[model samples]
Target: MQEFELINRYFKGRGISRRDVNLGIGDDCALVTVPQNSQLAVTTDTMVCGVHFFEDMSPRALGHRAIAVNLSDLAAMGAEPAWVSVALTLPHADVQWLEEFTAGMHEIAEYFNVQIIGGDTTQGPLTVTVCAKGTVPEGKAITRSGAKTGDWIYVTGPLGDAGLAVEARKQHLDIDPEWLKKLTHKLEYPTPRVAAGQVLRGYASAAIDISDGLLADLEHILEMSQVGATIQADKIPTTEAFRQSIEGEAKWPYILAYGDDYELLYTVPENHKAMLDNKLNQYGIDAVCIGQIRGGEGKIDVFDGEHKLDISAMGFEHFAEDEAC
Candidate 1:
């Protein structure tokens, strides 16, 4: 299929139709309106065929993930997602694949009320890049540099299930069919904590979405805020399938360093702890406090009860010598 025809049929005029988008797809430059008293939050992510996902991955899931990850970044900044532009590269236009892919993209975009503005489609090796935009009240966007000593650390939900899914796929480990299904779903269709992020704007001192592993992403906050932390290893949340499948030294990387779980990792000050709890509970958000910030310069100490465990692995880095995920 031709590029313009492909976009016109599958992407343009689909998904959520937002009033803020003055001009959407088919235009040379899409126009959008940023709300008054708000700042525009923008983020972009690129996923390649082999490097980011298996070539055989579902087109629908890839479409969902492409949008979800970008939204996750906006969510980290406590921004409400508004619009996205998707640039797609493909070997050829497969009709069924495009249908499933656009369906996935539109489904999530509709859920978040995001409109697809404009982007380019070209013939090449498979790759998908999405640039997402959102809005946050002026001076109300959460950031890594806002963390403070004495702030409580929290995560919106469990971690390591996605890591486990990746490991299982790579190692071909013998996993139960049902458990594998659940783990694989975590890796594919991740839920961005959009509402919880908005709720955290007034309460959280610092916030980040766990796209990279908890330790790796938390380090960003510590380095930016110039504060240290002590994380209770046992308090780190995990799924039942993850706990049942891996144990001991084998489990540490997935739990602490492996990436792809898109939950939120945030911090709240002592005085606002009760208020944060009440607010999260009221919104039915399941957040867990795992540690506390301390006075230091970008250090994180992990403890399993009284024992200080030696952990050296950081999260996934694209160019790191030893990449875990």
Candidate 2:
């Protein structure tokens, strides 16, 4: 199929309609209307075969994950997702693959009320890049710089499951079959906490999504906020499945340093705890307080019960020496 034909067949006119979008697809550049009192939040993420996922992995899941990762950014900033543009690279145009891929992409877009605006398709090694756009009320968007000393840190859901899935996929871990299925789902179809983010506006002192691992991602908040944190080892939330699948001490790497969880890690002031709890309850989100912000500049102290723990490895590094092809 021709490029335009493929686009029209699979991607054009897909996703939830938004009155704010003046033009989408078809044209050289798509146009969108941001509300008068809101700021646009834009993010882009790219997924390459082998590096990001196995080359033989499902195209449908890849489609979902490509946009989901970008949406997680908007979620962290407390923005409502609206529009997206996708660029696709493939060695050959496979109609069946494209169909399933677009189906997965549009499923999440419809769920999140995001529209596919415009994009490009071309020949190359398979890769998918999506740029997502969202909006937040003026001056109300959560950011990494807003955390203050005494604020409590919280995560929207359990961590490590997705990372565990990656390790299992690599044959690095011997995980249970049932647990592997659950972990694989977590890795492939991460739920962007859009509602929690929207609810957290004006309530969370600082916010970030755990794309890189709790330790590394939290450091972004600490550095931006010019503060440190004290996190209790036991306070970090992980699923019972994760705890049961991996034995003692071995689980810490997945929970703390392994990446790809894509859950929200945020902070709330001591005074906002009550309201924050109410919001989380209203949203039916499982969240746990993991630590408290402290006075030091960008340092994180971790403790297990009363003994301080050593934390040297942070998480996945895309540009690390070992990561190079």
- Per-residue accuracy of model 2 over 1-325 as CA lDDT, tens digit each: 3753565658776667788789888888999999999999999999888788777678889889999999999999999999999998888887888889899999999999899988898877787899999999999999999999999999999999988888777655777898888888889998889899999998999999998888989999999999999998788888877886887777887888877878899999999998998979987997899899999998999887888878886555332233422
lDDT of each: 0.88, 0.87
Off by over 4 Å in 2: 1-5, 314-325
Weakest lDDT window of 10 consecutive positions for candidate 2: 316-325
Q: What are the per-model C-alpha RMSD values against the true structure? A: 2.6, 2.1
TM-score of each: 0.95, 0.95
RMSD of 1: 2.6
